[model samples]
Target: MNRREFLKKTAVSAAATSLLAWPNEVWAGGTVNLTILHTNDMHSRIDPFPNDGRTNGGLGGMARRATLINQIRQQEKNVLLLDSGDIFQGTPYFNFFGGELEYKLMTQMRYDATTFGNHDFDNGLAGLQRQLPNAGFSFLSANYDFSNTILKNQFQPYQVFEKEGIKIGVFGLGIELAGLVDKKNYGATVYLDPGQRAADMVKQLREKENCNLVICLSHLGYKYENAKIDDRKLAQQVPGIDLILGGHTHTFMEAPEKINRTNGHETLINQVGWAGINLGRMDFTFSKKSKQKINVAAAVLPIGKTVISS
Candidate 1:
C-alpha cells in the first residue's frame, strides 16, 4: 500500500483495536483512567465578553472557567489542566498589567503546564520573564531555545506526571518565531524544528523516562496549505506521541483528530477556539496488559455562566 492508503487503514484499525477490543489480561491487571482538560489561545481574556449581542458575549470569564474546572476536579480523581499558549495579549487586562494578571489568574485556576505562543513575546522577553513568578505552573517548550536569554532557566523542556501509577510525559512545541514575532521581543530565542525536536523528546519520554503516555502542547496551527509544519504534520513525522493539544490558528474542532503515523502508531490532536471561548477535554483509559492499548473520548465544553457566582 502507498503511504496515504496505509495511513488511512492504520488510523481506522488503531482506533478500533484500541477502543473496541480489550484483551482478557487487561481486566486482570486493572485499569487507569486520566482526564486531561486544556485551553488554547486564551489571549488574556480574564472576563466574559460584554453582555452585548456579539457572538461570544457573556461567555468565557476566568471565574466561570475556574468553577467548571473545580467541578471536574471534584469528580475526577486524576486530572490535568493545561494551556496551549498565547496567554498574553487581547484584552485591557494584558494592556494594563503586562501579562501579570493573566499568569496570576491561571495560577489561581491551577494550570498544570503551558507553552509559549508568538503573542506571548509581545511585551518582549523581559516582560514575560517578570510575570513568571506569578505562575504556579511550569512553562514547557522543547523547540524554543532560550539559553542566552533571561528565560534560559525558566521553562522546562518536558514534565512527567505520575497519577494513580500512570506516568504521563508532556512537552511543548512552539511555532517559528523569526517572522511571526518581532526580533526585539523574541531576542536570542532559537526556534528548533518541531517535528525533529518532538521525535527526540518522545523517544526520551518513552524509553528513558518510561512514561506510559506522551502529550505534546503545540503552538503550531492545525494545518496549512503551504506545507508549513502544523499539528497534523507533526503527528505523522513523530512516533510515540499519544496526543497533541494545539493552538495559534484558533481552529475549533468538535472532536479530536486521530492521525496515523509511522509504525502503526497514532496521535490524537485537538484544539479549541481562541479567547477562552471553549474548554477541550480528552479522557484516556490505559490497560496494564497492553501498554499501547488506549481508549479515548473527547469533548468540547463551551464557556458560559458556571454554577459559581461571578
Candidate 2:
C-alpha cells in the first residue's frame, strides 16, 4: 500500500470500534493490542543517582524500572520487554561484578530478549561467558559468529513470542565488532555484515517462522554523517523489518521514525537513549478477522525521578 493509503487504512481501521464497549473492537476482527516496551545501552547503573541536582539524578535505577514494568505488565494483557545492546559496562557495578549483576537484574525484569554490544566484552570473552547463565532472557544476535569460541552455544539468532495471538519475531543485529572491539576481548568470534544478516534473518522470521510482526534489535545507532550503517541505513537496505529498536548512539527519541523499505512498506525505527532515560512503547493492534496488523501508536515515556514514585 502507498503511504496515503496506509494512513487512510490506519484511520479507517481505528474507527472500527464497538458501540457496546468501544476501544475493544478497534479492528474488523477483534483486535489484540501488543505493547512493546524497550530500552538500550543500560550500562550497569544498579542504583539511582545521588540526587546531585542533575535532572536525571535518582531516575534510572533497576528498582524504578522494575516497578514501572511490573505496573505495565499488570495493566497490559500482552506485553513484550526487550533491550537492544550495551547491557554491560559504564558504572562501577560492571567494574566490580563483571556482567553478572546486570544479567541477574535483567532476569528479574523478565526481559524477553536482548542483543550483544561491544561493551559487553569489557571483561573479555571470559567475563561475558561467566555471566551468560545468569541471564534469564535469551540473547538474539543474528550476526556475531561464536562458532569456535566460549560463546558458541550461549546465544540464539532470533526468538518468537506468542503474545495475545500475535506471533512476534524479535531479532538482533550487532554492529561490526572488529574495528570497534578489541581482538583480545572478542577472541575468535566473527562479525558478519549487519545488512546481510538483517535481510536474511528478517526474511526467515517473516516467511519461514510466519511471524506477524518482525522487530530488529540493532546496536548500529541512529543516522551517522560518516556513512556508517546505522538503523536508518539498515531500514532502507533491509527488507521485511517492521520495526528497529536502535542503540549505540544513545539517542533519546520521543517517537518512532517512519522509513520506507525497498518494497515501500513502512518501517519504524526507535531508540530510548542510554542509561534508561526513557522507555519506548509501541502499541500494535492486529485484526482478529484477517489476523493482519492494522494499526500502530507510538510514544516515548521519559524516566524522570517520579516515574517510579519510590
Candidate 3:
C-alpha cells in the first residue's frame, strides 16, 4: 500500500479495454467495482447561475447534476452517492426555504450519506432539526456529540453498506464548531477530537465490522499554511481511512491526492469545488480472492460542462 504499490494497483490507463468493459465483466467475475459519487459545499444553488457575466455563470444547477448522476448510475451497477456537507446557506434558496428544498432534492438524488458543516448551523439547531426528516439519507457525525441536545439519536457516527458482497464502512468528521458557529445556534453539542475519534472509528470499522473499504466524510478544510487539523493532517494522523471526501475550504482538486499513511498504506483525499459545480467520482475494484481492493480510478465530472476522468 505504499505510494508506488498504490499507483501500480490503480495505474490501469483510462484507454485500457479492461476499464471499457468494467460495467459488464466486473460482477460476473470475482472482482467487484464500487463507484463512489460525491459532492461538497453545495450551498443551496438549486438553480444554475444567472446569465450575467460572472465566471460561474450558468455553470451549475441541480437539474444538470441530477442528469449527470443518473447517467453514471445507469452505467455503474454498484454506486454510492455521497456529500461532504455545507448543504445549506449561501444562496437565497436557503434564506427562503431554510434548507427544505436542498434536503428534498438530495433525497431525490439518493445521497447515501452527508456530514455536518459549520454553515449547517446557520438556521441554528432547530432549523436543522425540522429539515432532518426531509432527507432520504443519514447524517454521519462521529466527532459531534449531540447526546445532550435535541439532535440526540438523530445522527449516526458511522454506517456500513454492503455492495456486491463488499462491506464498505463510512464515518463522518466535522470541524470544530466553537469559533465558527454561534453558541446559541449549536446548543449543547460537544465536539470531540477528530483525529482520536477517527482512529477509534477506523479500528471498529476495520476489525469489528470487517469492512473492505473505509471512507471518511469530512467537513474539515483541505489544508492550511498554518497549523490546522485539515484533511491532510487527519490522513497523516489516522491509519485506517482509505478515502477522505472533504469540504469547508471549497478546494477544487483536479484529482485526488494520495497521502502515504503512517502505517505505510495510502489515503486518498478528494474535494470538489463549492456551489454544486462538480461531482467527484471514485471507482475501487476489489478482488474477492485477496479480500483487498486492487484498483482505484477517479473522475471529476463537471456539472453542466464536459466530462473529465483521471
How much is 44 displaced in model 1, in angstroms? 0.8
Backbone atom clashes (below 3 Å) for every candidate = 0, 0, 0
89-126, model 3: which lDDT tens digit per residue?
98889999999999999999999999999999999999
**lDDT at 170, model 1:** 95
Error of 2 at 6 (Å): 26
The model with the greater TM-score, 1 or 3, is: 1
Please write out the lDDT profile of model 1 over residues 118-220, one tens digit for every residue: 9999999999888888999999999999999988878789999998778999999999998889999999989898988999999999999999989999999
Residue 119 deviation, candidate 3, in Å?
0.4
Worst 10-residue lDDT window for candidate 2 reads 12-21
Overall lDDT per candidate, in order of appearance: 0.84, 0.81, 0.86
Sort by TM-score, top down from the best: 1, 3, 2
Q: What's the CA error at residue 123 for candidate 2, in Å?
A: 0.8
Model 1, position 164: C-alpha lDDT score: 78
lDDT of 3 at 176: 95
Give me the runs in candidate 1 sitting further than 4 Å from their true place. Answer: 1-18, 288-292, 305-310
